[model samples]
Target: MDRGTVGSAQSGRLLVEVREEGSSAVVTPAGELDHHTADVLREPLEDCLEKGYARLVVDCSRLEFCDSTGLNVLLGARLKAEAAGGGVHLAGMQPVVARVFEITGAEAVFTVHETLDAALAD
Candidate 1:
């Protein structure tokens, strides 16, 4: 497993953990994600996509905050996965994070689930 810390402002913190599971790559993000941390997500995510993983799951249950930058990274990841004949799913989004997606009209764009288990089941 590899971990990268992103945001560290007084607002919150963000850490992204990357791990492999069979043919898929899982990115577990813990903490707040804003403009400062969005790029941190893009790097690893694009790396996994380029590695030919068939599925990408971003676990956000532990995420306490997010901004448009974070959302852009997610949408970008989804696009990358689709371009590679793969899929991107979001799991375990906290209420605030979920609300960001909804307010931005991204809830309809992402296959978001309440838990990692549910996302994996799909």
Candidate 2:
């Protein structure tokens, strides 16, 4: 995956960073997320689910854009997380990134928080 550390992926357009906070795994994808960069985010999310850390928190404060491929990655992660008796939480979405969710009704499927701290608290 060319990651500098475990559970992280970085490319020219995207950087997906993963960290554990309590029982939750917080994945922060910073930069554009499109067809080319989707796997950078997808792999770690699936890794967390496979490891049984089903409570996934996506810190999207730094994310700038998301295309259908990127959205699909998240939706897939959410379903897997739920199947494991946990769920995906999205926090700190920028207006551009949040609009994609709002228009596609993806936001309703996720627990949206205004900040990363709120997501962690929940």
Candidate 3:
């Protein structure tokens, strides 16, 4: 795998970078992810699944914030990936973003990794 960015999308609040690692599509979204910027992250994730990268690793170390809509976008991706025999893996989640998942019990539904490297390794 080249590890180069296969695609990317950026909005005012979010910048999403997509790359390939083995069979997993690593999507890194930096900055705030809210209702207004959810699509910036969603499109790249959906595109990864469409392109047959069923495993998704979200490197959220750079992500500073995430709202409910942002969580929904991830949940949606998880469902899509699961349907295709894959699942979403969340890695390096910041405290704020992780809090949302915790509050919503979304963490229970996905495989959460402490780091991006760990996520890809699994």
Leading candidate by TM-score = 3
Better of 2 and 3 by TM-score: 3
What TM-score would every model get versus the actual structure?
0.85, 0.94, 0.97
Query: What's the lDDT for all of these models?
Result: 0.78, 0.92, 0.93
lDDT-superior candidate, 1 or 3: 3
Residue 13 lDDT, candidate 3, scale 0-100: 80
Report the C-alpha lDDT of model 3 over 37-92, residue by residue, as the tens digit: 99999999999999999899999999999989999999999999999999999999
lDDT tens digits, residue span 6-121, model 1:
22223236777777755667788787788987766777788787778758988888788889998889898898788888888899988888889888899998788889878766
**Which 10-residue span in candidate 2 carries the lowest summed lDDT?**
1-10
Off by over 4 Å in 3: none
Candidate 2 residues lying further than 4 Å off, grouped into runs, are 1-6
- Order the candidates by lDDT, highest first — what do you get? 3, 2, 1
User: What lDDT score is found at residue 68 in candidate 2?
Assistant: 89
